[model samples]
Structures are given as C-alpha cells and as structure tokens.
Target chain A: MLIDDNDIDLKINGKIVAFTKTFEDIVVCRSGEEALNYLKQHLTTPERLPEFILLDIQMPEMSGFEFLDHYKKLPVSFTEGCNIAMLSSTLDFSDIQRAEANPYVVKLLKKPLIPAVLQEVVKEHLQR
Target chain B: MDTPSVKVLYIDDEEHNLQAFKASFRRQYEIYTATSAAAGLLILQNIDINVIIADQKMPETTGVQFFKSIKDTYPDPVRILLTGYTDIEALADAINHGDVYRYITKPWSDLELHNSIKNAYDAYKAKIDLRNKVSELEKTNDELNRFIYSISHELRAPLVSVIGIVNLVKMEGLYNSSGEYWNLIEICSNKLDFYIQKTLQYYKNNKNVAEHSPVEFEILVSELISLYSYSDRDTQFNVKINQPVGFYNDAFRIEVILGNLINNAIKYQKSTEPNKFVNIDIDVDVQRAEITISDNGIGILNDHLEKIFNQFFKSKNHHGSGLGLFIVKEALTRINGKIEVTSDLAIGTTFKITIPNGKAT
Candidate 1:
C-alpha cells in the first residue's frame, strides 16, 4: 500500500513499485485517514489487509505519524504482519529519528521508491 | 537635535537636599523628588523614570543600597549616587561593578548635576534601544530557521517526485533518445538537492545545542564515505582510524564535519589523474580526536585558503553551495574543535581537525 497526499508522487511511486513486480497488488491511499478507513473496513478480512505500508510523513488532515498512532490502536490481527515503511524526503534529523523510533515502522526510506530499495525490503522483511 | 526632557528621580532622606535638587534641575528636566528610598520605590512602581539620583547619607537606606535593591526590578533606570568625600570608597566599587552608573558629590555644581542627568539618560535610552534591536534580531533569526525548514521541505518534495519520474523513465530505457538531456536534468537536480542539504546542515549546526555521545570514528568516516559515493566520481578513499578508547562528542556535528570534508575531497579530485585518492586518518583517545583528511586534488590557492571558511566564499572551480566549510567551522566552534588546512595549488589539500571530548560530568 502506498499513502501520500500528492497525486503525482502516488502515480510515480505506484508505477515504480509495480515495475518491480514484487507485490501482487498496490493499494493507494490519498491520505492517512482514508488509509485508516480502508483498514477498518477490511478489519475482518485479514487477507485483504496490506502486507506492507509505504507511508508518507507529510500530508493534509492526518499525517503519517498520526496514522501510525491510530493504526497502533487497531486489533493486533489487523496489523500483526504488516510492515510500515516511512517513505519521506524529510531532511530533519528529529523527524527521521521519530520515524525510526516508532515500533511499527520497519524502515525509513528516502523518497522515490527505487527498485533497489524495494528489493532490499523484500529480501529483508517480506521474505520472512 | 532637541532632546526630550530627561525624567530624574532624586531620592534623599534630607528634605532640604531633595528640595534644592528639584529647584536646580526643574527648568532643564522633569524632576520627581522622593523623600526616602521607600518613596522612590513607590514612584518607580508607578512611573517610568529614566534616571534615579539618590543621596548616600540617608537615615533609612544609603543610595548605593537603594540602587542595588532595585537593580532587578527597575533595571532600565540608570542610577546616579550622591555621596560625600567620606563615602567615595564604598561608592567607587559600586560604580565599577555598574550597579551605579555615576556618583555625584555633595555641594554639587549645577553644571555637574545637569551633565550627569543628561548623560545618564542617554545611557538609559541607548540600553533600551539596544535591547529592542537584540530582541528583533533574535525574532528574525527564529523566523529564518522556520522558513528554511519549511522551504526546504516544499522544495524537495516536488524535486524528488521529478527524480522519481526520471528514475522511472531510465528504468523503462526511454532515456536512450534523450540521454544527454536526462543527464543534465539529473545533474541539475542533484546540485539543487546538494545545496538544499548544505543549507539545512548549516542551519542545524547553528541551531542545535552541542550534544555528547560515544563517537566511533571508523563507523562515522565510513558512513560519510558511502554518503558521498553517490556522486559520479571514481576517487579512491583510503581511511585509517585508531580509537584506543571510547571517544565522546556530538555525533551530528562530527558527521557534518566529516561529510563536508569527505565530499570536498571527492568533488575536488584531479579529473585528469587516473589514480585519484582521498586519505582520511583519524586518531582518537578518551580526551580528543585528531582527524586529517587529505586528497590528491586541485588544491586551494594560498590566498583563497584563509577565506574558504567564510560564508558563501567560493573558489574558481567551486561546485558546492559555499556553505560546506563555513558550516564545518561553525560546528567545530560549537564543540570546541579546531581546524587547519595546507594546500599546494595543483598537488592536493589536507585539512587537520582536532575536536576535544565533551566535558564528562
């Protein structure tokens, strides 16, 4: 799943991820709230939940960090196996540290989801 | 220029002296007479008095004692002490310490009294003006920091998106027709990103308070080397580090220092020389870390060496934002570190840096 407010980023990142052909499907959420809603709606359908979440930190309404706060409150079954990777262009060290310190976050990748990073993600976390 | 009347408060227990002072200065100034130190404190609470003149031989409180008492509360008002020759010794110390701005002797000349009030008020006004300017400067500095952070974020977001699109095009092999254009775009974007990062680094070095953490030189130098490897340069890095004991310093600033120097070493490498190399030697102990970064590159001119640490100072073959070395110097200052550079125009340049361990409490 890819979450970001920018449409251009979403389109570009989505296509890049698809080109890798690592995942079966790519879910796009325009905002953190929409992602939360999608997660809540498919709470009972465990298989429908996203296996990996590529979250953008900066967004309108609910930020990626705020989304993580809400996501943590959801039932463990809904979030148990999912990996939250913070995908951002933030240069602030505090923000980077915050993202890294989050329990649910598996990694913080700099923006423009290149194939090499996706492959590393697959090898490191997804393979297990 | 016609100056406004200086508001003067004369605090004295002697009713006659207060009356004489008011009578003498009434025409030239706004005279406010307080019979005792208590009355002067009351007047100060209610009014904005620019200068306060107090007599030393008061039954309740001496003038120097009154000035000292109101130092924190009525700090804006410049204090003038009136004393006899006998009390000069005590008042001299107060004057030196700046608790009292000036001291006037008893049986004072009208000229001396008038001059003291005028000059003291000027000092008071100058202090206030300087304080206002300092606060304004601080406000502007804070706003600039906020602006830098937000602007960088806004600038980088779309840039990375463009980079993403560029990467996608390259992945699809669509750049074969316009490879040069793509390369140019990539170069420009990378330069823009580099400048943005440098600006943020400068800001961070200025704004952040120095922090102390265990520093591993091998890890830090290697990380910086890898960070600069993305640049399309084939400069060989030969790093040597000896850390016999755990070194403690600001990790962020250490990285900034190493990052900029390492980046410069790679960026300024001799393009024609097939065997371009950078040698980073680090020696660390419990007390300090001494680092030397040398490169076989086009070196800085003797004249340019002194000015290189200056903000926005670029050399002839400048490719950086000109903030790299300046930020390095500033970060060093924060951590109480020192740097020295030696270069021969075409042979190479070497920078020696020494950073002391943060105080262990």
Candidate 2:
C-alpha cells in the first residue's frame, strides 16, 4: 500500500487508482504522529496493518524522524514486517545520513518519485 | 585671476621688507605674516598652511636652514625662497637641499605669487583624491570576498546533510516499508543539485564577458518538464513552446533561466489540491524572446514580491531556500534579460521573462 502526505496529482492519483487493482488496501497520513497513532490503534487486531508506508520527512506536528523514534519503542508486533521509506525534496547530506542511520528507515528516495524507483525498491526488498 | 590665500612668513631682520610683503598681498590672500623664523615655526604648529614662502636673508638663520627644519615635520606644504641678488647662492642651496618649489627675486610680481600657490593647491587636492579612491576600492574588495565565502558555506552545509543521509541508507542495512523516507532523500539531493548548478553558473558568468551563447527554448523546456515529472501515475503537465520564426537565441542562458522558473512551479505548488497544473509559453523575435510560466498553486504574497529576487530570500511558503529566483535574476542579467511576475494568493502566479536577442547596446 502507498502512503503520502500530499494529495497525489490527478495523473499520479489515476495511476495509483489503476495500480490498486494489485494491492488489497492503501493508507494515508499527513504527519508521522498521525501515522504512528493510526498504526498503534489498529495493531490491536493486527489484520488491518499495511505492508509498506511511503513516508514524507517534512510535516507539521511530528516529522518522520520523530515517528521512527516513537515507533522503535513500540512492540515489534506493531511493525511486524512493514517497511518505511523516507521521501523528501531536501538534498541535505545530514538528513541523508540521519535517514541512513535510522534502522527503521528502508531508503532515502528523492522526489519526484518515478516508477523506476518504486520498481527498484520492490525488486530489492519485496521480491520473494 | 584672484590671488590664492598663501600663508607667508617673512623672517628678515629689516622690518621694512616684512611690512612691504604684508602690504603687497594682504587684501588678495589670507597672509599669515610672521616677523621672525621662531614666530613662523609657531604659526606652523596651529594652522594648516599649503605653501611656506620665506625670505633667504635673515639675522640668525638663512632661508635654507629654516626650510630644512620643517622638511620632515610639515612635508606636504610646498616651500619657496624669496631672496635679493646677493643671497642668490644661498637660495640655490635651499632649492636643491630642501626641495623648495621655486625661488623668486625680491619685488616678486603678484601674478607670479598667485600662480605658484595655485599649482601647489592642485597637487595637494590630487593626493587626497587618490587616497580616497584607494580606500573605497579596498572596502569593495573585502565585501566581495565575504560574499563568496558565505555562499560556499551555505552550499556545503546542505550537501553534507544529503551525503550523511545517503550514507545511512547504504551502511545501516535498514529496510523500510514506506516510500516516504526515500522521497525525503530525493528532495535533499535535488536541492543540492540546484545549489551546485547555481554556484557554477554564477562563477562562470562573473568570470567571462563573452562566454554566453544563444539558448534553445523548446528543447530545454521539454527536458525540464520531463525531469520534474517524477510519478508515473501522477498528474501530467503539458509544456507549450511558441517562438516567432527567424529568431536566433542564446540556448545556454535560457536553459538556466527556465530551469529555475519551472523548478519553483513544481516545488511550491499547493499541497492539498490533487489537480496540479503547470503551463509555459515562449515567444521570440529578433529583438527579444519572452517566456511565461504559470502554475495553478499557492501564490506569493505582496510583501515578499519585492524581495523575491534577493539572495537567500524565501517566502513563508515552506518549499525552497529562496535562491532559485535570485540565481535566475543573476543569469538573466549576464545576458541583458528582464523578468516580471504577477500572482494571486492561493490561485496562481505567472512569471514573464524577456531576453534580448543580441548584446545590450
């Protein structure tokens, strides 16, 4: 499932609408705080958990980094096998280093996210 | 011509010549008439005299001796010797040893006196003007150096942040299910690329006067739009190009200009809206080439429009470092280009850029 803060453009949204044929569900959140809250509230049943989250680093309340900080202390069952990829428009080296250092972070992807990047990620991590 | 105000000191023991000298030029000049050498030395201590004319024949001292005494202490004031035929040899000695400006015979003409003083004043003015110019140039050089240093620091800091994030992704063996983390990394990288390009363009434009070349409009616009179109399934943006026939253009500079404008449109668009649209129009003639890029997004406020082109100036909108427009303006200036903008908040903004076809006359 794909998750992003921005309202996906009509063209990309259309693509997502088309791609959903292959996926069972998708989740979206505006901030890392909201994402973490949603995961915690839903983890009790564990059936509604998403396999992937398309995370954005810059947000209003809690950033992606803060979300990861809080996510680390939560029970492992909450995360399970879910992957979190950080997406940003910042080319800052320190941000890149911070994302790389975080264990929960899967990869640091630059915008705008094209199909090639998505395919590469799926091939490297989810191909089984 | 009006006689210049010369500060003359007569040191002759004979009171008659001292009175005669005062009577000769008192009305025409601001004469600082001193009777003795010691009194002349005292006057020099309080006032700024431009020329010091002294009598060669004195009771206790010669004009050469008095001139020698003040040479090092009051170096700027031009020194001259006034002497009778009998004191001609001593006058020569003063002129050679003390570097006196001129030697005048007794009963010197008022016109001759005025001419000498005027020449000395001109010399003094020239020296002061030269010194001021040098000091001003030094200040400008220091400021330019400081500007280059700060630009380097700002660029490097962001680059370091991007590299650090990239390293973490590679070394930590961490895996994420969400694509958000990767998006952040991409944003950082793109920003770095923009800054590096800007720095290079600035350096190149400043270093050479003749290196700018005509730009290709249609090709550059196509390339920029394709680069920003990141999502395969995202809203598609249509870029349009219309140039007047028979117009030749400078392709390189136009690329840099359009690159910045289009980048901002993509970067600062309203986030809540799903139907994001960016439009570009280009028209060129022999005299100038005009381009307009408009986007359906959140627009800039009135207060920020004035400072939008200033270095490192960013609007309250949280998308860019504010260097994009600044760099665009700089690049445009090198080619004698002009840019103007009109926008409505929350609706859209349009940028109109005109590039002169040939070098500015």
Candidate 3:
C-alpha cells in the first residue's frame, strides 16, 4: 500500500515500483484516511492487507504520524505482518526519530522512490 | 507602538505635593496626580502610567509599603520614593523590598527631579526593550531551525523527482512521448527555481537596499495579477490604478509584496462562492501610495491576524507555503512601507498597504 497526497509523487513511485517488480500486487492510497479505510476493509483477512506500506508524512486531514497512532490499535496480526516504510520529503529530525521508534515501521526512505533504492529495499528487507 | 509622551503618576498625601510635582513635569510629560496611595493604585490600574512617584510620609501607608503592595500587580511602572530629612532608613527599605529605582529628597531641585523622571522612564523602557529583544531572538532562532527543515524538504522533493525520472530513462530507454518526461523535469526545475527565487528575495530584502525607479503602477499591477491567476480562470479580478503621475518606488520590493498578496488571494479563494472576486485599488501621490487588496475568500481568523506576518505562521484553514507574508512584510520594511489587514470570517479579507513614493533622483 502506497500513501501520499501528491499525485506526481504517487505516479513516479508507482512507476518505480512497477519497474522494479518488487511485489506481486500494489495498492495505492492518496491520503491517510483512504489508507485507513483500505486496512479496515481487509481487517478480517490480514493476508489481503499489503505486506509493505509506503507512507508520506504531510497529508491533508490525517498526517502519517496520526495514521500510525490510529493504525497501531488494530488487530496484532495486521500491525505485525505489515512492514511500514516512511517515504517523506521532511528533513525534520524529530519526525525521523518518531518514525524510527515505531515498531511497525521498518525503513524511512526519502522520496521520490527511484528504481535503484526500491530494488535495494526489496532485496534487503522485503526478501523472504 | 511606542507612545509619543511619557505618562508620569505622582502620589503624595498632601495635595500640594502632588500639584508641585505635576506643575514641574506637565510641560515635558503627561502628568497624573493622586493624593493618596489608594488613589494612585486606581490610576495605575486604569492607565498605562510609565513612572510612579510616592511620598514616604503618608497618613494610611508609607511610600515603601505602597510600592510593595502594588509591585506584584503593577510591576512595569518605574517606582521612586520621595523622602524627607532623616528618612534615609525608609529609603533603604524601599530599595530592598519595594524595588524602588531612585530617591528624591523633599527639597529636591527642579533639575534633579526632571532628570530623575526622565532617567527612570528610560531605564524602565530599556529593561522592557531588552526582554522583548531576547524573546524576538529566540523566536527567530526557532523559525530558522524550522525553515532549514522546510527548505531542505522543498529543495529535495524536486531533485528526487528528477532523479527518479532519470532512473526511468535508464531502465526503459525512453517513453513514446519523451516530451512527457521532459515536462516532468521542467516542472521540477520550475519548483526549485521558485524556492530559490523566494529565498533570495527574503535575504535581498533583509540585507540589501533597493534602488528607486519609475513604476508604471497600472501596467506593473496588471502584469502581476495575470502572473498569479490560475489558468482555469475561476476567480474574477478587479484592478484599478489611479496613477496620474507615474509612481516612483522600489519596484522589486513592491513586486514581492504584491506578488505574495495576489498569490494568496488566488490560492485561498472561496470554493463555494460562484462569483469569487479580488478587488485591488492603488492610489499613488507624489510622496506616498496606498494600495488596498480585497478578496471574497476564506478569511483569516481574528486570532491569527497578529501572527500572520510572523515567519512560518500559516492559517489553520489555509495550509500555504507559510513564507509569503513573511517575505512581504520584510520587503515592505525595507522600503519603509507598512501593511494592515482586516478580515471577516467566511466573508472575505482586505489588506491595506502604505508605502512611500518619491521621484527618482
């Protein structure tokens, strides 16, 4: 699941993910609210939830951190199985620290998600 | 805003003593007389008196006791004690407990009294000014820290986009319309250019002085409105320039101020209102120009008015880039100009800009 408010960012990242062939399927969400709704829809079957989640910080209604605060409350299986990645353009150290502290979050990637970095993430963290 | 005249409050048990103090300082200062400590407290509470003088000998309470009583409630006013002969001990107590700044003897000379009041007000103001300076420094330091993060992010986003597009070119070898890829690069380049230009504009306004030149207000303003307006043509605009004498001002500074305001007027436009409009009137004379920009859009809340000019202060309703007003204010200050804003919630906002206009010599 990819979450970002910017359309261009979403497109570039989607293209990179497609080019890398990192996953069998991809779920794209424009905002944190939509991402939350997607997770809720797949609540019963944790397998339906995207394995790797790419989230952006500065969204309209609900920010990426706000999403984390809400997402952690879900069933343990859903939270534990998904490895969330923070893909943001923020240079704030506090934001980086908070993302690092979250247990569900595995990586903090600076956007716009070029193919080389995507290939590396798939090889290292997402590899079975 | 600093008041033109110093407000002095004199308190004494004897009405004659209060009259004497007021008579001496009335020409130089705005003097307020209170016959007793109780009366003086009332005046202090009601008025922003800069300095307060008290007589040591009184029926109900001495000057030291009175000063001590009001020290907590009215700490800003500079306190002075007037003591008679052999009241040196009371002066000591006033100094230690009451926080009295200066002591005037009962038979004080006119020159001595005049100098004391002037010095007391100056000392009081200096202390307050220092405190204000410290807090302002701290605020700017904080904003600079936040700005570094924001600027880095803004700069990095575009560079990363270009980097990602380059990776696509490497893998796929090119798209059917390579122009599409080139367009993305151009967009990123323009975004970066805007950030660079705005940041430079902020520094230039702050550090460097601008040259005065003949400004064709009508043409310059119309060009600005066109540049900022969206291509969709949603918001209607009305511009009126009454410039019989072609205005002379710092064109760069004016551009910065007008550009930011015009951009905001368009960006935070009312979505529900069909006939959304922006009205601008520029009236220029030989020495000054007053421009008013009004918009029927989502107005700022009354609380955020004071802070809108502050760096990185964005309204809760409108999540703007947050640098626009800061730059506008900076440029205005450079050109010795001022801006005033009034807004009605859900109705609209209006900004009044006042800048000096002189012939290019």
Candidate 4:
C-alpha cells in the first residue's frame, strides 16, 4: 500500500512499485485520515490489510507521525506482522531521527523512492 | 537633511510674514501660503500637505485650534506653530493640549524655522519608512520560507521520477516490444533539465546586474523562435516589430522575460491539434516599448491567472517548475517594466509587456 498526498508522486510511485512486481496487490491512500478509515474497514478481515505500507511523511491534516499515534493504538492483530515505511523529501537530520524513533515504523526512506532503495530494504527485511 | 521637494504650507494673519516665509524657502521646498488660518485649512484639504506652519495668533483662529480642528481630517502633515508671543505658559499649553509638533517663536530667524520644519519632516518620514521596511521584511520572510519548501520539492521530485522510470525500463523489459514509456523517461529527463536551467537563471537574475545595449526586436524574436521551434516542428511563430531600430534596453533581462513567455507558448501547445502558433507584436516609441505575445495553446485557467506571477504558484493540474512567470516578473522589476497577462482556458494566453525605453526607468 502507498499513501501520499501529491498526485504526481502518488501516480509515479505506484507505477514504480508495480513495475517491481514484488507485492501481489497494491493499495494507495491519499492522506493519513483516509488511511485510518481504510484500516478501520479491514479490521474484521485482517487478511485484506496490506503487508507492507509506504506512508508519505508530509500531508495536509494528519502527518505520518500523527497517523502512527493512532495506528499503534489499534488491536495488535490488525497490524500484526505488517511493516510500515516512512517516505519524505526532507533531508533534515532530526526528521530522520524522529521517524526512526517510531517503533511501528520498520523503514525510513527519502522520497522519489527508486527501486534500488526499496529492493535493498526488501532484501534486508526478507533476510531477517 | 537633503531637501526632497517636501510640500511646505505657511499660514499667518500678516501678509508680510507669509511672504517672508515663502521667499526664504521657495527654492528648497514646494511652498504654499495663506493669509488666515481658515484659508490655510482650505489649502490643507486641497493638497497633500507634508508640513504645515501656522502663526500662533490669527484673526479667524489660533494656530493650535487650527491644528486641533484638522487633526482628524488632515492628519498626515506635520504641524508647526509660529508665534511672536513670548508666553512660555501658552506655548506649553499649546504643546500639551494641541497636537502641535513644535512651536517656533515669532520674529523668527530663518535658520531656526527651517531646521525645525526639516526635523519635523524627518521624523514624519522616519515613521513612514519604518512601517514600509517592516512590511517589506515580512513579505521577504514569507517568500524565503516558501522558496525553501519549493526548492526541496522542485529539486528532488524530478530526479526521483527519472530514477523510478529508469528502474522500470530495466526491470519491466520496457525495451522489448512496445516500449513507448521510454519516451516518458525522455520527457522526464528533459523536464528535469529545463527546471535546472530555470533555477540557475533565477539565481543569476538575483545576483547580477543586466548589461544594456541595442535590442532589435525582430532579431530577438526570431532567435527565440528558432531555439524553441526545434522541439516542436508544428509550432509556428508570427513576429511583428513596429519600431526595431534604435530600440535599446537591457538585452539580457529582455531575453529572460521574452524567453520564458515564449517557452510557455511552445510548451503548452495543444499536442492533438495541427494548428499551433505564437504571435509576437512589438510597438515601440521614444518613451516606452510594448511587446505582446499571444499563443493559441492549451491556455491557463481563469482562477490561475491572478497568481501566475506569484513565487512557486503552480496552477493545479499543470506540470512545471512554476518559476516561469515569477522570473519574468523579477526581471521586469529590475528594468522598471510591467507585464499584463490574459488567458482563457481551452482558448489561449496572451502576455503584454511594457518596458521603459532607454536606461531602465
């Protein structure tokens, strides 16, 4: 699943991820608010939940951090074994540090997520 | 304290006093006089009086009374009271009760009165200058913050797009049968290059002074047309110059302004249609030169027209570096020129540029 507010980034990122053909199914949510709404609908049938969720850091109403605050409170089984990654254009060191500090977040990558960055992360995670 | 055509108004009951005041300061200021306080009030309402000098005693009204009366209606001009009366108590009362800026004793030395008015005008100007500077700072601060955010987005967004596309080409077997998406990668790379060039131009515009020289309008137009015409062969440029000779201005800045507008004309052309054309018209005289460029391309939306010149304002549903019109505006600023744009979506966008003739006004 890919969640981002920028329409260009959303469309381009989706195409990039789909070309990789790693994930069987891909879902995109525009905002953290809508992403939570999506998660709520899938709670009863947790199988529908995305295995790997790529969330954009900067959004209108709810940022990636604000979304995690709510995401962590959900029952463990709904998010169990599901991996979350943060995507941002900011190169600010503190932004990286703050995103890394999040326990639910498994990966933090700078934006325009090229295939190499994603493949490396996938490789590292699959090895573990 | 350089005199800067400061408008000075003197009001005294005695005709001799008013004449004497005007005579002394006529060369230094735009001086006006009234024989009575009532007549001075009339002049105040008529003009943008910068500094008002009223004798303390008048047949119709006291200087302080006149100042107090005009306080609300004519408040901008600094008020000075002139008096022969040596009553310190009265002067103190006028200073406290009236909004009298300063009181000058009568049988005045010309030097004393001149210095007093100069100081009052200086103080008045300082307050105005401070307010303007504060607002200008606020505007610059806002632009700086926006520029920081946009630089990150504009700089990174394209590179990521390119990388993502290149990866797809390698992984998706895009080179095989119908690799049309390869063209997209090419377009993406070009867009990135275009933005990089524009960013550098924007930086250079802010840093350097433009070199001025003779600018032949038709020659510049043809050069720009050839430069852009390479990409889109179908696009046509119709150039017209009413006065091309002896027309001199800052060539580099004009190029910057014209280049950006003409580029937009080419870029926004309706790809599906066969008829793609840009019309350039230049009307010049001794005072100012007006250049109009119109395009029958996929025009800008009505809502986006007002904000096109704003820094980093990209019209929704449009893809660009969003600095084209802004750079045009900045370059125009340096040359004391102005641009007017009118566009109708699905029809066209027309830009009319008026630049001062010789040296930048």
Best by TM-score: 1
* Angstrom error at residue B169, model 1: 1.5
* Number of backbone collisions per candidate: 0, 70, 0, 1
lDDT tens readout by residue for model 3, B1-361: 2656888988888888777777777888999988888899899889999999888899898889999998899889998888877676897798899999999888778899889988999988998899899999989976775585467556767666676666566567674466686657755655664565566566556644677888887888888888877444888889988987767778877987998899888878778889989999999888799999999988888998999999888776666657889999988887889999999977899999999987778
Give the alpha carbon lDDT tens digit for every residue of A21-109 in model 3. 76888899999889889899989876678888889887889999899998998888777667888887654445788898888787788
**TM-score of the A-chain for all models:** 0.94, 0.82, 0.90, 0.93
Q: Write the per-residue lDDT of candidate 1 for residues B133-162, one digit (tens) a residue.
A: 999999999999989878987898999888
Higher DockQ: candidate 1 or 2? 1
Better of 3 and 4 by DockQ: 3
The alpha-carbon lDDT assigned to residue B131 of candidate 1 equals 100
TM-score (chain A) of candidate 3? Answer: 0.90
TM-score of each: 0.90, 0.45, 0.50, 0.41
Q: How many backbone clashes does candidate 3 have?
A: 0
Docking outcome class, model 3? acceptable
Q: Which residue pairs in candidate 4 have backbone atoms (N, alpha carbon, C) closer than 3 angstroms, thus clashing?
A: B83-B106
Off by over 4 Å in 4: A1-128, B1-184, B209-211, B359-361
Q: Which sequence of candidate numbers ranks them by TM-score, best first?
A: 1, 3, 2, 4
- Candidates 2 and 4 compared: the better one by TM-score is 2
* Model 1 lDDT, residue B45, Cα: 94
Ten-residue stretch with the least lDDT total in model 3 chain B: B200-209
DockQ of each: 0.84, 0.02, 0.31, 0.24
TM-score of 4: 0.41
Model 1, residue pairs in steric clash: none
Q: What is the lDDT of residue B79 in candidate 1?
A: 88
- C-alpha lDDT values of all predictions: 0.87, 0.69, 0.82, 0.81
